[model samples]
Target: MNTKKQILALVAFSSLFISCTKNDIDIVPQNYTIPDTYTFDRNSTTSVDYSGQSSRISMLQEMGDYYKTQATAGNEVNETVLNNMYSNSGNPFSSTDLNTSGKQLKDKTAASTDYFTLLYGGGSTVEQASVRTFFQTQFTQGNNASLGNNAAVGVAGKYLDGTSTRLFAANGLEPQQVVLKGMMGASFMDQIANNYLSVNKLDAGTNVIDNTNKVVEAGKNYTTMEHNWDEAYGYIYGGDIASTNSFKFWSSYINQVNNDTDFNTLKAAIDLAFRKGRAAIVANDYTTRDAQIAIIKEKLALVPAVRAVFYLQEGKAKLITDNGAKAFHALSEGYGFIMSLRYTNKPGTNNPYFTKTEVDTMLNSLISGPNGLWDIDNISPKLDAISAQIATKFGFTVAQAATVN
Candidate 1:
């Protein structure tokens, strides 16, 4: 036979050999099929209640406004309002306290259940205790002129004390406003990106199958894996996907990113990634499932990283022009984003891309001077370094990230 004919004959023979062996053994290859689409049952017992979390966040904003109005009017601070705002006893945000019903925010202590305590205290007990103490101190002290103009806005707004007035919205938001904004990216966004959607947690042994089949709770229909993925999804879009309120967790940041065309694409990609991952879980295709999880982490990490770079550049430009107020405002946001880098979940890494030490070092570089940002000259280099570190960690260049926000 000619060379071509010989090669064809050999390939045919090999195929026959493999087929005969399989037939003789009566063995079948593993099924690893991936589904084309999946429908998430929002009412499934396994599904997370994002609307409830959103309500808590809204209550936080209302609490801030209430305190602001009370302080602004020079009215005596009501002890009941303070208790309800900080604990689950009388939440103005919900007719029924979610904490008591074992709902979304349930299991959280009254002292640790409030938005401020939840955001600052969730990761660290020390921070939680400190936040609780801080809240008490602010309210007990009442609205005092000695605390300065920002403090005069309200107890909840005291976090904004010494912050630049330019950071305040034209309509006015307390320091809690910035804190809440930062927490959206830092806490809520991070929880979805890192903790729940983490590949390590998802693919732990047979967790993909076990968790999906084993309903830990008697009444819940969701497997551990299914519930975990839904919880992650809840943090980003919550129960209502169409709503775009500025106070909503992911919607708030999405609105900001939608202003940029490139970032808009990235944002859409995140939505797709989340859906695909959830569907993959249903299909039992671990390969596709983990891939989507990685995509979610990488893209979500970029959101905050890009914003950090943008704010750093904006802050630098404002400082160079001697607009200290705007500079501090921008830098404050940048600081929050920097702090958020520690929450990104990377495969094969126990820790986040950026370490706490690295974040602190960068933060100190920007605000350590006698006058802080005001006295610091040419902070562009420090900002650039931070941007570069984040970019390098994520395998991207600063140029690509700078335009995202």
Candidate 2:
């Protein structure tokens, strides 16, 4: 045989030998095929489902919409209502599906095994409750500010930047931006990188066996392992696949940063990684599956790190121009992005780029003075320093991530 023919024959013989020898797991041969799209089938039926993740994404979308309207309508935000919606209790949503979905953004916020358990002191209910309560408090303060005219030093109210009006707390942080951004990290990013993709969830008890045997869960189309992977994927690419309208939180921000030429292909890279990982799971190619997981975690984590620097840079330039409204809006976003860094997975490790303590200290420096963000004299240097640290950890420079849009 010629050299090419001999090589092909050897590969075929090797695949057959490996397939026959493998007993504990159903390992696909080197020639195993992976689908171009995220679709899998068993017995001629579709086997992918991530409805629960989709519901929670929608819940956050609805919650954000409701919060934004409160100040504009001259209405006081209700803490009880916000809490109910967050916990998915008391039928707070207008959508009947969400009211009955039994899924809330609360259980998932900072709920990842890696970071959540550590930050909450080994899953302490007290710490979790405090975090929820703090969110409600901030929402109330920002919404209540709408009852007055524009905000001033040590005041909470709306501020007009150009033609747009934004509400802020007494210290200059916009509650909407801060809370939403923080959740993007604490809930979505944490769950994706630190929870579902982690071995704690993927390779947990019986996951390998269930995946290898294609053992579908009771009344479910996919196996538990497959479902867990789908849930992670759903958090970002949920809702309508055709429209960006369905994008919220992490989904929205990923696309936002992808617009920059430096990271223009990020969306495609993440999508391919998710698709390949899912396909690898089906093919029983654990090696490929794990490799894809690393890709997904590293790339997805970069979203927040890059944005944290981007927003801080934007806010810093506005501060130099003495534009309070724009500066505060951008910085509020920066605060949330920084808050998210604690949830990021630092490839091949169970730790994040920044610990919760590091993130909190960085956050404190931004809103340090009596007037917090209004303490303009003390803010610029802090923004620069924070941006540098975040960039350094992620192996990127401040100038690269903080590129102007």
Candidate 3:
């Protein structure tokens, strides 16, 4: 056995000598204490570093804001510019740090080992190209606004909303919502639940040895393992230790879900798991570290699942009232959230709650008709079935997730 396996075996053997409670079953080794917060240091210098993740988050913020600008009158989304931003090439971002950060969203979407590797097996290379298809469709459909056709079955243009307008494609789907919320799953959530948090990245090669020895990389403050863990946390919290403001993408939806009284405890629970897991890594308590990983996976998975149902409920109610603009907007968001479901971690398993095929099927069911949302006069039955499926997998009732603004 290797050093990590041997040490874990010894720890397991030693556990028989101590009586432990359920809460403390994975006892910390003696002489090392876990910090109350996510602070870790050696020689009095802090070792936390997730600057790479911070850069990507900021990149998405700039990119999403730029996409939203295309919705305005007489503005068009330049496909090449958006593509450049997605790849972070040709200095697409206005921020100097982001331009030089060398991080790009195009490479990260649906790129996690647990999601992409399992879903695509060895076919991950082609999957990257396939994922960028969303960008092409977003710009293609969004640019349709300049055509001045009122959005309908095969027409793409403005959807009027109480004197204002939101751009919609021929199928009543907002182009930006599809790409933005799709990235919430394909990039942010996938990286956290599947890529950085997975053992493939966390304990790969000498990561455990390096982290356990406090052997910081040359010219860097943190060990490889420490950096990997923080990267996962950064995706959700955006490197903001307080996690209170400036929320974007997945963090924005997480905050949205947390605001609902039915699911108010989610943010705190997820934040605590991240903090405790980082502390456990510092203490060399791999058992506790792994346990916290499970908690993070399971909790993070629910954010997408609950939000998918919530948006669907919102769309169904608005559609019932014959509000086309509001209904399409809600349903478009629901569509993106459902697309996100394939990226969720199912706890103790590398698989997501739903497969890519399953998510695609659900998405197709939503907009299967020629008219899409425009044709669906009564969408409650379809919405309820999709919501119930999502809620059932997460062990919550659709009614529970649907009871909010």
Candidate 4:
């Protein structure tokens, strides 16, 4: 019995030693040579087409412009045009019949096609009803001429008193316009910068591995890495990929910046990064893929940051010149851009470049003063502070961003 016990103990020790040795010796060698190019099947059924979203934005813009023009002319608000903009039934924007047929149809009883209403409620039935009620109130208020000159205009950014009211200020620009534009940067641009293209999602375990091996998952048409890259591309390109002009969505803003010599280099780099990232995905070169994604995030983030600072400075300068309307316009845009900073991607960290609290603090500073932008006191200090916060978060000096024409 003692000899048997001794034999068991010896076997246990031998097993432990073998396990340790195996663990110590096990090493999966990594392939250092990443191919510069690879042929890949680019066609994939897993991609989401954002053409609907793009079309919706364009329709909203057209509707907003029409309302603006009507209000500016002080003409009797046209109910037909208003109804066609967004309605409980037969909304022209999302109607496939109207879009495909190219036929002008009015009040076709097609069901409510309100995009904002749908988005605001997250497509909830209860929330949609509430949104419809809110729209009704706004529409009713718009039709009332006694309320104010701008009351009939449901468009955002139009000021009734030309400067004091929230709904429509004296600038003839609806606050809604500012809200929508800010949403474009915050939601759409940020989705691409911080969400879809983010390393966390793109480089998740087995994703890079699957991508490298061109392993298409069951029921998926594309490899994991290929699908991820395409998803990021969808946010910006939507169905616009076929077009040679890749600068359609957020790239449009970058195009404006490109006009300025200081930002032209970045504008070029932005397009190049996206192209290289897509190519790297095809090549299964993760190092190049990651580098390009970083470039895209940093450069795209700079657009809002640079614009926020630029508009803040412009607002201050306009205030100095006593151009209150123009000052407010610029400040409003700056405020929107500031809010977008919370969506900037910070690689290796779950947090964005700025937090929501930080964004609110900066926004509050701009609108909290006794006279706000109209206080007549130099706002350079306040603008400088905001600029510094952005600069610090993004690893740039305020001076560099401010001086970037």
Candidate 5:
């Protein structure tokens, strides 16, 4: 029983005592999990079952509606950078078509420079990180996982082998994939929506169809579908075989609805087929830039998070006149749904991250970094080329391409 022996004994006793005390049960009740005050009807918008109607088209349409609502809200957002995002003062369209008494009509902060005001004429301040955080959360947070899953966003995020022409040998994807990603995919969304919409109203015998994928009729004799219809023959209209996978041209499919025996059945069938079909295609093709963006109609539909923060950034720009507000707003979700609605990535880099170039140019074709496209000069100019790459890759206009730098 020397000092060392006594210390060891004391240590053993302490360990035993703590172990015994650790087992004491404290049964605290579990905390409550409350639902969000605002949430997109996931049940209504997303597919729980990949069964019949549970498809990508339905998902996109639902998400599209969500974006449309957000766009409406975003249009109303009037911060410094986007001070005029929702001005009713001069634009007759805003006065008559786009506004409601109490509701906010979200519009993209499209202008190079403009602004939106706070409620009751309150002014806006410019903060970059703050806006980016708010906007990113709006898209990535509790809204809908479908809207922000790693599945599509990260499907094929890797450096592309630097080439002169982003050619079409990805195999059967050859030339088509490029078109889908750059040309068709960019315009495909609205094009497909309108195509389906055209066929959506056709009657079979004694049935009527509505926007929702619902029907109220029966069938008779339907006609064969024709994808070569005048409406289905262009960049946005043309439904290129997105991948080696099964591709359905909803434009043609919807047009064939009249050929179906039951108008209601075809109506339901076509509506579900096209809207959900496109969505499904987009969902499946997320690995490719074109298809991924095609399904990502968030920008066109107008996400409020994107718009709000975008305007806030615009406000900063107005106050500072340095584009700091614009750049800062680019990062926020609630401030500007840029994260949710748009892809910011560009081409020619060793990274898969988005660039402001992509966000700036959606459909206008200006500078195509055609694989071995734009030649990079000095390091700074090469970085500027990333913006050009994005604009060209996504089919943006020359003007937009100029703006990206």
Candidate 6:
């Protein structure tokens, strides 16, 4: 985990992210130590105060609760949208589709023209407009503008806000839905990065879908999964990025920017995004692209591969086998998603990991197995502290990260 993210994660899982309401007593803020009932800063998100108990157990419990509640909700929505997207993708043969149709009647058209709201669900139009406006304001004014790279930060802001409703739902504020917002945001950016590096990202985003398919073999539900091109080519032309990796995100940014426009701020945003792209590539200020990529790679190498077991009552079960590459791809894509573009660092321009049918098979196998169900309880808020840990590990948005646990 990066230092900043680590601090946030510690704060989130420490006595700060979760508080005890089962037995409410007079509470006090950590700093004041007074007998106040509400022990938190109003401005601070993920406020936690359970008296003097920095108890790890309590922390885990609280983290679990927060994650499960929000994650389940988000997953329900995510699965629905993904299912709708590939309802007919019994087998997504890119060659066949590209050959048959001039353009696969997909969401690209929608994303390009109506970035305010893709064909997906969960977010309202009013909310999208607000989120778009927020990014616009920030691009021209916020920390990015002050640094002369407001346009660059602008891209991050737009991408962040559009991914999840939870971000803006935070008191109807701009991108305040901290938990799911972060998770979904992480997912989107990760997808972009994976695609940029030519790593797979699709099949992996469906971790919850596997578990939801199990029938308790009783109670259950289900869930796959970018944008940009032209502007991206421009970047490659300008040498901010190679022609290859630059296209996907650059086009996406351009299409997205045009789709979600407030003309007054567009020019500035464009300039800033160009600057941000350069900065990311290792401009004079901040870490260069190479350094950032190295940092991301180091962090990923240290991350533990996901090891899970879904113990179930002995019963009828189905097993399908293939190379574990698919599972690894899914898991790795998720890792990159949560951590940002770091894991995408690859030899040449190719992303080393990504979603594929092989991965889908493994992931489905895991979730469909007995151990899969058990892990639900394991990853449940009552047990594991997945949310905060994921957030800290990946610098994900607080919104979605809070739900992963």
| TM-score for candidate 4, residues paired by index | 0.63
Q: What is the lDDT of residue 219 in candidate 2?
A: 88
The reply for model 1, stretches above 4 Å from the true place, is 1-39, 42-52, 59-174, 199-217, 239-247, 258-264, 320-322, 376-381, 395-405
- Positional deviation of 359 in candidate 6, in angstroms? 2.7
What TM-score, computed on C-alpha atoms, does each candidate reach?
0.66, 0.88, 0.87, 0.63, 0.20, 0.22
Q: Candidate 6 lDDT, tens digit per residue, 209-317?
A: 3212311111211111111211221221221233455422222333322332222243234344333322322111212222333333233322211111110100011
User: For model 2, how does the per-residue alpha-carbon lDDT over 3-113 read when each residue is reduced to its tens digit?
Assistant: 999999999988986665213365776776667777878788988788888888888777777667775665666766877888999999999999998789988886776
The segments of candidate 6 whose C-alpha lies over 4 angstroms from its true place after superposition are 1-186, 189-192, 195-291, 294-349, 370-405
Point out where model 4 deviates above 4 Å: 1-53, 56-67, 73-174, 203-224, 237-249, 376-380, 395-405
* Candidate with more favorable, higher lDDT: 2 or 6: 2
What TM-score does candidate 3 get on C-alpha atoms? 0.87
Per residue, candidate 4 scores C-alpha lDDT tens digits across 1-405 of 699999999999899866542123323334433324322343733232333345544543554555455555555445455555544235544446435543221111111221122221122345335433533344333444323443222222334345234334332223434544555554455557654576656766667666656677677567666665655555455524445764454556666656666677886677677667766665655567778888887787788887788777777777778555556667777776886676566555544567656777997787665545554464668887888777777666665555555
Give the deviation of candidate 3 from the true structure as CA RMSD.
5.9
Using TM-score as the yardstick, the better of models 4 and 6 is 4
What digit string (tens of lDDT, one per residue) describes model 5 on residues 1-405? Answer: 999999999999888856641113222224322223111122254221211111222222322234233333323111221212222223322233322222121211110010112111111233223333333333332123222222111121111112211111111011112211221122232232222222221212221211112221133111111111112222122322446433333333333323323322433332333343233222222122222232322222221222222233333333245322222222122112222223211122211133223333421221123311111111123323433443344444324322211
lDDT digits (tens) for residues 1-405 of candidate 3: 899999999898788645443234334557666566667776898888778888888887776677665555446767677788888899999988888887898888878876577553222656666777876668677777545677666678876666556778887888778888888788888889888998777877767766767788899888888889988988877735354566767777778888889889988888788888888877777788788999988888888888889889988888878657668888888898887787777777677789777887899888887778777764667888899998998998888888645
- Compare the candidates by lDDT and give the number of the best one: 2
lDDT score, residue 164, model 3? 52
lDDT of 1 by residue, 1-405 (tens): 899999999999889866542113222225533334334553553244345455555544554565556555546455456555656555444445543533322122212211223332224555435434544444444433213344211222232323322223211222333444445544565556655665545545556446444444356656667767776776666534454433354555655665676566776777777777776665555566677877777777776777777777777777778544545557767776776675665555545567556766876776555545555455668778887877777676777656654
Model 3: CA > 4 A from native: 1-37, 117-124, 162-164, 239-244
Best by TM-score: 2
lDDT of 6: 0.26
- Residue 253, model 5: Cα distance from true site in angstroms: 23
